[model samples]
Target: MGGAFVAAALLARLGGRIGLPTIPLFILAGILLGPNTPGFVLVADPHDLEMLSALGLVLLLFYLGLEFHMDDLKQGGRRMALAGGTYLLLNVGAGLAFGFLTGWGTREALVLAGVLGISSSAIVTKILVDLGRVGSPETKPILGIIVVEDVFLAVYLAILQPLLSGTNGPGDAALKAAKALAFLLLLAAAARYGTKIIGRLFDTRDNELLVISFLGAAVLVAGVSEWFGVADAIGAFMVGLMLGSTTSAKRIMTLVHPLRDAFGAIFFFAFGLSIDPGDLPSVAGPVAIAVALTIVMNVLAGLATAKMYDFGRGPAGRVATTLLARGEFALILATMAASAGLNPRLSPFIAGYVLVLAVLGPLAAGRSDWLARVRPGEPQPELVGAGK
Candidate 1:
């Protein structure tokens, strides 16, 4: 654990000197020193850091929830939903098409659709903070899209699990879907109407007690959410959302920074540790095609979002690049596919695809201005007439 932190920090510092983002650097550190690599293995088993990594994800989303107020949702509710729906339709739909085109089994294709569809919430949240764009106009839609994806994930998992298991009937899948929807609605209602009750729960003056109270609630709620077939990240996020309305939101935010950064680093590093560089070579061709597809689709989605929100090219570029990385969810799907014995090639394809984008996403987002300048546009009326 100590070695993981030191290595990530050192690599991130080196990358910072060159204006590179810390996210990929942290993952790179883990890959270099992990068991898969032929070098000094800091932790032989990736599972050793699983608990810490999970905490990192929870806190990251929790912080995101705190920062996202209920008013933002109220203001952009319909637009946000439409934008998010558009993004999913383009990316996930493309993924399904690509999956079928691969001649892989139907189950493998379903896994690929999810792998190609969703963005990494952890990486996206981290990029917003690192780039100092947390409060930027573009971030709201980006976050809203993630919220929509989270809910979609719950439904998708319910559908996918039954198919993969091959034992459960449609009734079972429907039951899971209902439970997931119920849990989400329950949390949404709490965020809407139970702010006072939640606020009082964390109203203690002592910092220690306050921390324990909020942390316990987040983790407990997150665990229960998993039982209800929802992603724990959303659970933690909803906890943050509910508490965000309370007077203590600022206090919780201030206290969670170090925890989020520390655990978040661990999450990325652990992700890298699970990848075997050896597995990437065979899937290089497919991975390249998938990466290209994801980039193109994200740009279109970004433009669509910008048009909906009446934003300029710069904001469009931010939306496209910030949501480029694919991490935890892809990995989870890969793991599930492997367990279900779907296809031998699916895991390697996902690994290579994720590794490429994990590095590229942050780099592109940091330089999103390039996309704006390079994009073709009609000449300005003033410049055209004056030059003429």
Candidate 2:
């Protein structure tokens, strides 16, 4: 873990110079320390990394949800839903089609579709915030799309868990899904109505108590979500949504940002630690093919989404680029595949693919202004018009 931190910091510095995300760098550092790589700092115990990694992922999702206020749907419901729905449908369709074309079976194809359809909410949201695009015209719809994808993420996992676990029959699958759905609905209702209770208890002036309350709520909810067969990420996210509704949301966000970055680094590093670098060589070709497909599809779907939201060509193109980076969620899905024994090859293949695209995705987004060649319609700021 000590070595992982040092390696990630160095790689992140390198990534900053090259317009890549620190996530891929973190992962690359782990891969270098993996069994297959002849590195001085190999990870001796992968299990120890799992809990921290899970916490990192959970925090990342929670931060994202916190940043995205629930009021957004009231402001931009139709367009956001339509645009996000469009992206999901198209990307999933494309993923399934490609999976079938390449002779990956139905189950593999479904998993692949999930792997393809979802973008890394953590990465893209962070990038947008860092780039100061959080207030841009395109941001509203982009965030909306992320929220929609997250909703589907919970549903997909709920449905997939039973199948992957090899439950006895259809009855078992239905029962598991019912349990998950009921829990999720309860969570949603809590986020809606329970905010007042939280506001009363936690919306206080005591900064230390405030911090404890926020962290405690997120972690407790995440554990409960896991207990009920719902993904812990979902629980953290829903907790975030509830927290964000409070008057103390900004203070909570400020306090949590540092924690998110620290644990988020572990999450990415652990992904790389899980992979055997020696296996990457055999998977490179397929990984490249998959990357190409996702990039093209993301651009198309993302562009349409931006246009539907009435963004200019430049912002639309930028939105497409922003959508390219697939981080935590992809890794999560890939890891799920590996754990279930449903598709061993899927894990390695996706690990390699994510390494490349994770880098390329951010690089492309950083330079997205190259595609902003349009008649000067709406005057834009220097950053939106041209890359610095």
Best by TM-score: 2
Instruction: Report the lDDT tens digits of candidate 1 across residue range 38-148.
Output: 968899998999889888878877887787776764676899989989999999999999999999988888989999999988788878888888888789899999877
lDDT of 1 at 367: 77
Q: Where is model 1 more than 4 Å wrong at Cα? A: 103-108, 121-167, 309-318, 327-348, 366-376, 380-388
User: Model 1: how far is 12 from its true place, Å?
Assistant: 1.7
User: Which residue pairs in candidate 1 have backbone atoms (N, alpha carbon, C) closer than 3 angstroms, thus clashing?
Assistant: none
Error of 1 at 281 (Å): 1.0
TM-score of 1: 0.83
Report the number of the highest-lDDT candidate.
1
Clash number for candidate 1: 0
CA shift at 235, candidate 2, in angstroms? 1.5
Supply the TM-score for candidate 2. 0.90
